[model samples]
Structures are given as C-alpha cells and as structure tokens.
Target: MAAQLPIPIYSSLEDAFGGLRTASGQSVRWANLAQEFKSRFGREPAYIARAPGRVNLIGDHIDYVLFGVLPAAVEHDILIACGPSMSPVSSNSGSVAAHNLDPRYVPQTFAPMLKSAPLPTASEERDAENTVHAESWHMDIDTKELRWESYVKAGYYGVLNHFFPAAAGSTTTGPHPVPVDLLVTGCVPAGSGLSSSAAMVVASTLAFLAVNNKVVGLTKGELVEMAMENEKRVGVNSGGMDQAASVICTPDTALYITFFPSLSAQPTPLPTSRTVPRAVFVCANSLVVSDKVVGAKTRYNLRVVETLVGARVLAHHIGVVLAPTERPTLREVLGRWLGFYEAKNVPSDLDTDMLREGVQKILPYVEKLRPTRDDGELGVTMEEMIEWSGMPEAEFRQVYLSWVDVEATHFQLYKRTKHVFEEALRVLRFRDVCFSSEAAILPRDTLIDLGALMNESHQSSIELCENSCPEVDELVRLAREAGAFGSRVTGAGWGGCTVSLVAEDMVDEFIRSMKSTYPPYKYLGDDELREVIFATKPSSGAFVLKL
Candidate 1:
C-alpha cells in the first residue's frame, strides 16, 4: 500500500490546520505528461506528483517571521511525472536525471558524488566548511548562491537521505535508490506571485518519494516540513507558507496556516453559491516576474535580514535579555512586551484590542526614526533603531545583522514590525467574515467587508512595507477601477501578480475592462489574456497519481 499510494489523507481541512478541510473535486488528466514521460523515458511513469500554486487573499510577508497567513491554492499547479530507471544498477547509486517539458528549464543529468555513506537529513546542521553531510551525495557550492537546478536537487536529496540512506540497500525493506527520469510540466507561471518554485520543489519531492516507495505513510505536515527545509539550500530565509499551502490547501477554501505554536492549517470556508449571490477571485499578472532567486541580496533577503535585526533591536529596547544569534520575530517580541505590561497574571489569549493596547504601551519605546544614507525609503536605519540601544555595535552585529550583508544601514523596523502584526490581525478578520454567521444572511455586506480588508492589505504592503513596485500598483489600480471588489499584491511583492475579489456575474466585464486598459493585457491576444488573467477557485493539496 505504501508503494502504491500517494500521501496520507485528511477527512476535513480544518482537522488539518486544527487538522484540514476537503472540497468538491476538480482534476485535469495527465495525458500530456504521461505521454511525454513515456516518449522521453521509454516507459510509463510509475507515479506523478502534483503541487498547486496559491493566491494569498489577505496576509502578505508575515509567514517568514512565523505568523498566521491565509492563502488559497489556485487551480494552476506544477506537475512532475517520474519513475525509477529500469536499467541495470550502476556501481554508484546516487544518479538522477530531470527533464522539463517546457524547454525553458535545462535538463540535468547527475552522477553520484561517491559518498562514504547515505545523505544526511535536511534538519542536520552542516560543518563550518558547509560541506555536505558525511553520508550525503552532492555539495552545492556557495551556500548563498541559488541555481535553477539547486531547487530540484534539494528536493531529490531531501527524500533520498530521509528515506533511502547509504545502508538502505543492505538492510532496508523499502525500495532502494535508483536513477530517476523526471519530466516536469507546469501551468503556474515562474516568478509570478503564485509560488511556482515551491510548487516545483514539492512536486519533485513527492515524485522522488513515490518512486522510492516513501510516499504512503508520510503525513501532509511531514511533507511540508521537508519541502521548507529542502528549499533553504537556495539560501533565502523563506517560511513554511508556500510549501504548506501547496500541499494542504483544499479547493473552494483558503488555508489559514499558523506556524508559531506548531504547524497547523485551518481551511476557512470560502463563499459558495448557496452562501452568496455571487463570488469569484481573479489573478492578474503585472508581467514583471519578481524572481526571488535573482537579486535576492538587495530585494527579498535584505528585508528578511532587516526584520530579524529589527526584532533584536526591539527586544533590546524592551530589556529582554536574548542570547546572541537569537532572532525573535516581531510577533515574539510583541508577546514578550505584552507580558511585561501585564506584569502579573497576563491573559493567555489576548484579543485584538489587547494587542493594540500592547502596541500603545510599546509606542513610547519607539522613537521617531532617523533615516540612513541608502534605502531610507524603507524608513529607519540599524543605527537609528539602536540609537536608544546601549548595546555595542560589534555585539549587535554579531547577534542580528550577521546573516546577510546589506548596503543600507537604515532598516524599516517600525514599518516591517507594524505590517506583520497588523496584517496578521487582518488575516484573522478576513477569515472571520468568511465564516461569520451573517455571511449567509448578508453575503454582499460580508463580501464588501472582506474586500475592504484586502484593500487595506494592499495599501499597507505599498505604504508600510514598500515592497510594491509601480507596475504592481498600476495593475492593482487597474483591477479596482475595472470593478474588482478589491485587489492586492498576492506574492512577495516588488513585482509579480495581484489577486482580486469580484462577483461571479461581473467576472466577464472585469476581465474585459482590465485587459483593454492595462498595457500588458492590451498587447496580449484574447486567448493569451484569458490564460494570463482569469478567475480561479481554491484547489487541492499535492498528491501523487499512478500514471
């Protein structure tokens, strides 16, 4: 059963986060990938792995620091058809080859690195030289750099080391390591806000696991953790949001995933025909792909580093004695500070009012920010953040800003912290509207409230986070003007795609009007625009198919 099946099942999506929710099914046939796999590899694919792309309805950029994020798995996904090679066993075991049907991605044929033993688990720490584990197979040169193939290799290695160790052959009962022929086909656009990279990595991981007979018993949560750790080989400090959303999402419902206490995904019920007069979600690409891999130093990773540094500075301001190398997030710092204010007998669960009140208490500690020479637009500098900090520069540097180098001395401590906490609350509010008892009686009002939350999220991302670029702003503006209920940048901003709320009846007009007015959509033909800009429902989690 383990060899024949895909992943563990969930009875409901809520049980998934609390445990997960399930949905009405929607699936496409694997006729093309199946045919392509056979055509290229000379045999049928033993199994296929599919992972969907997600559209964030409200929450943005809060997942990394470990807060709640609400994202819906859209219909588009990455699919990989794979099977173990039937050829005679090689003297060396760690051989795997991958082919992308799109042709944009170059195929890689890898030979075993001739390891002394099996690969190490991703959870294990690397030595000072950052060498691969003693048992591992390959070494990715330069831990900071990212390559297209590295993502795939990370997935392959994750499953291989976890399930098939060096000693696996001598004593293990499961399938042994074999050369895998992988054929990838993706509907999700790369560098779009929809998370194409995570989907690809997940699809690859599942495929590798299945071919090696490692799929059946693995829980969704377990797979999610593996995917998140595997992608870290690419070097960005991304959170579990993308990986978890792709794996645990249910169609017609958005997953409200929380990483703090533990990994859990609560599938919030989306409006249905029965609950509402009409409801639809549309995703429009700015046509500017914000590839996190490229320019990570200046763009994404810088923000990540800034947040951690900001967290450390705030902890210092509050007199919280944290060890060096401790990177507490804004959420953690806020909770600690809230405890400080509560003094004796702090409430275990603080409501929004109480949290906002906590912010009020901490407000006096926050100084009017001083700008740095470069990147002052992000708001405050490291120097200004610790102007009130008595901690020495060397110690601060050792503790917080050591992970990634930044050209900007100034960081947006206030904005970054403010956005994460407020947006985390906004996500909760959006979920509230989705599940409110009044949703059935007052669908239009509920929808309007939800739209307003999305609008606020966009403004915050633009004004507070400063991650939204001109292209993204323009597209969001165009969508709203074209009659979207609300629109916001869906992925890690700077440029990518925007998700919009719309009425089901108004979907046709909304798409048409935006296409005519928007430059990117104006240039594309109707058929092209249809694929590029369309409404979608929440989709299912990653699963394997016996092809």
Candidate 2:
C-alpha cells in the first residue's frame, strides 16, 4: 500500500483545472458561479470548493461488502462558493445562509443548535467487553424527508462534532466556526447513479473546512473518511466507494478503491488500442430518481442487511468461526474461509489473482445459503435466517438490524451473496484488463471483454441484487441494441442512470439512437436531453480554491 497525500489547494484556475487547456471552460463555470454568488449574497466570495461525481464503471453493490470497486470521477461536479457571513461573530457556533442556483432547492439559512452533554467518567464508560462510549456534539438532521441543504448540514456536523468538541467535562473549549454564506451549483444529476450526493457532501465538507482553515493538512483519504461518515447523517447506510471515488480519483484513470485491510486507492489507466479509436462512457439518465434515503428501508438498506446476514450464515456453514455478536461482510467471510485472514498482509495485499480465484472457489459455498424448503422458495424467512446464523433472534436483530432500518418479509440471502461474489470477481478482472500493457495491440478486444463484464454485472444486478428498475433495464437494452459495447445501471439502482461503454466515434449516433427510441428522451428537447445524458471522461477529484 502507498501513503496517500493531502488534497492540493490551488490558487489559480490553471492550476485548479490541472492545465491551461481545460481552464478556459472551467473558468467560465467558476466565473458564472461567482457572479451568482455575488448576486445571491452581497459580496465577493472568499473560496470555492469542488468535488466531482463518480461513475462506477464496473463494480456495484459489492462495495458495501468491503470489496474493491472501479469507479472514475466524472466531469460533472458540485461547487460551493462561500465566504464569511457579515453577521457578528459568536463564541459558540456559526450560522450559514445557503443558496442553490437550481431554484427547486430553496435557499436555507440555519445554524447548528449546539448542546453540551455530560461526558461519561472513565470507569462509567468502561465495560468488561471494552465497549467504550462517549457523549458527542449534537445536530439534528431529518433523514425521513429528503432535503438538499441537509447535505450541507451533514458536512458541517462532522466538522463540528469532530473538530470542536464541547463535552461537559472538557477542560479546553473548542473555538467557534466562522459564519458563512454559500452559493451552490452543480451539473451532477441528483438521484442518478453518478453520485451527486457524495459530490455535494465532499464539496460542502471542503467548503466548511476551507472557511474554518482546517483543510491545510487534510489528506484526500481523510476527507473521504469524513465524507463517508457525513453522508450517513442523511440516512443512507452506504459504502465508501462514492466518497473515495469523489475524493481520490485522478484525471483519465479509474480508481480501484479498497476498504478492507485499509482504505486505499490506486489509479488504473484506462486502456486504449492502436487498432481502434478511443472508447468513452456515455451516461444516460433513467430520470426515475433513485432516492436512497426514501427507499432505504425497503430497497438499498434492506439489501445491505440481507448481504451481511447472508455472510454470517454462509460463514457458519463454511466452518469459519465468528464471534456470536460479530456481523462480518462477505469480503471478510471470504478471507476467513480461504484462510487468508491468517496471512501477514491478506489476499488483497499482493495481486488480484488470489482474490479472483478465492471468489471463484468460495462461490459454490454460497449455495449453502439456499433455503431448505420443498415449495420452491428462493428466499428464507426471518426466523429461518436467524436459525441459520446460530444466533438468537434478539441477538441477530441487535447485531445486524439495530443500527440500520430495513423492511423485508423474506430475505434473499442466496441471491445477494451470489451477486456479491460474482461482481467482486468482475471488478478484479476489470482492473486487470486496464492494467495490462498487452492490451495495447488488442484494445478493441479489451473493450469487448470489459463490456461483457459490464453486461454480466447488469444481469446480476437484475436477477440477483434486484436493484434495477424498468427504465434502467430499458435504457440498457436500448444501449446494447444501439451498438454500445456494454451497458449497466450505475448507482444504487432502483432507478437512476445507466452508463454504457461506447466507441468515441459512435457517441453522437448512439445518443441519437437513444433519443429516437427511448421513451424518456423522446419528449426532451436538445438542452433537456443534454442535461439527462452525455458522454463523460474520467476527471480530477475534490479540491479547494483560495482567492
């Protein structure tokens, strides 16, 4: 593993965009945002924070299982123009007036309702189990109804609770954050798989950090960790892939992000063949809005519990020992089963071969999770699942169901497990192809193989993970029919967007084909169609700009 460095802060547009060539376009966007900021708030802005949304090129739901995922940061991003509020300084906390260029999201002006809870004594918090707990700073975030500014608040909450602690027993009180006025704008389509939420959270986090002068030495990985925790405040039990891709990605390469042994990322260059034109990814929105928070209990979060519980049951059958209270992910279960857990650095430490083969070897064991019923039931009941885990119902509920809320009468343990293992293997293979220099001669062949993996991934998502919707499935089918190399649903998947691997030369034609055929695109005019779908390249990650 390599040591990750701090995110760079740039002073000029040329440096921010990485070169003068790309700076022209970005300069216009930033200038427009600044102009909007000046009109919205009555002064020149002090700093701008930017975080790009990501398109998961290969991996999907396996990320929550601690598996590595291949995702690239797209050009579409969230930008926050912020400066100190004119309000009088307060010793306790800061206030914010947040406005969005998109009118649908109304402006919000609010402040953190700070409260100091009594800190527990050392012995009072200690237990024989070493389960230590501490009182944390409080901020209310309504996770039920979806709100745009909640993301802004979520970012602020982490900075406040982590950097400015004020427990009752504290000797030194933390300094108050400066009041801020922010104007937000983004091109990343929200509710689509492109990870607009993560972009928003990451940018908001950077904005808060910059305004407070705390971004001086923060590593990109550290920012990713904070954004991951921050997003949970909005009620989604998501994995770290989105935040990692948003914070750690580099231009022209996809990131292979792993959370297992540790959070680490490696940028894998996208392959290109001398025999064929370059390939690009086209993002086509399903326009169905996959709201992770709104559908979490029954959809996204439900799958998470199913996968975790499935791992527990599978581990029990595979003779892997787990603590009675332990809730291991499928990746951890695979490590234990392959005896890689005992290795000095583990399977993922070396190369993808060991991990790929391990997934193939353990895949047959996933059948152990199949329900032992005669009526042809594919899923197991809650009671049956508990029995399979060898844990009491209360304990099972406490370990897996206590923290997150999920609702499902019958859990598809077998399907979820199968999808995870298969998808994990695909991600490893995808990374291998991208890293293979031999691909130079057969770049077209490489694209085909990659596309096949994406196609297979979408099928698994449909049959096993059950995350795709009709609009997404239709878009994928249309993409394939329109000559895309491969296509699949890209995000949390109940509905959002489908990313397709298309030849660079055929992109315009492909978009034309989609518009002529796909129902959603039929009514959209040129501008509306552009907003809903477009070709994208791997772009730079999150950064802060100082004036």
Each model's number of backbone clashes?
18, 0
- In model 2, the runs with Cα more than 4 Å from the true position are 1-3, 89-92, 117-135, 166-173, 272-275, 342-350, 438-441
lDDT of each: 0.73, 0.85
- Per-residue accuracy of model 2 over 1-547 as CA lDDT, tens digit each: 3217788798998998878989888899899998888886778789999999999998899888999999999999999999888745423356888899998999888766444444346654433232212225544467777889989988887777667665333425656677889999999988998999999999999999988888987888888888988898888988999999999888988899988877889988887433275789999999898878887999989999999999988888889999989888988888878776635555344357888888999998898888778898889888888888899889988998888878888999999999999999999988887876653455488888889999999999999999998989999999999999999999889899999999989999999999999997998999999998899989999988897
Worst 10 residues of 1 by lDDT: 19-28
The estimated TM-scores of all candidates read 0.85, 0.93
Tens digit of lDDT per residue, candidate 1, span 473-522? 99889888887778999888888889998888889998889888888788
TM-score of 1: 0.85
State how far residue 298 of model 2 sits from its true place (Å).
Answer: 0.8
**lDDT assessment of candidate 2:** 0.85
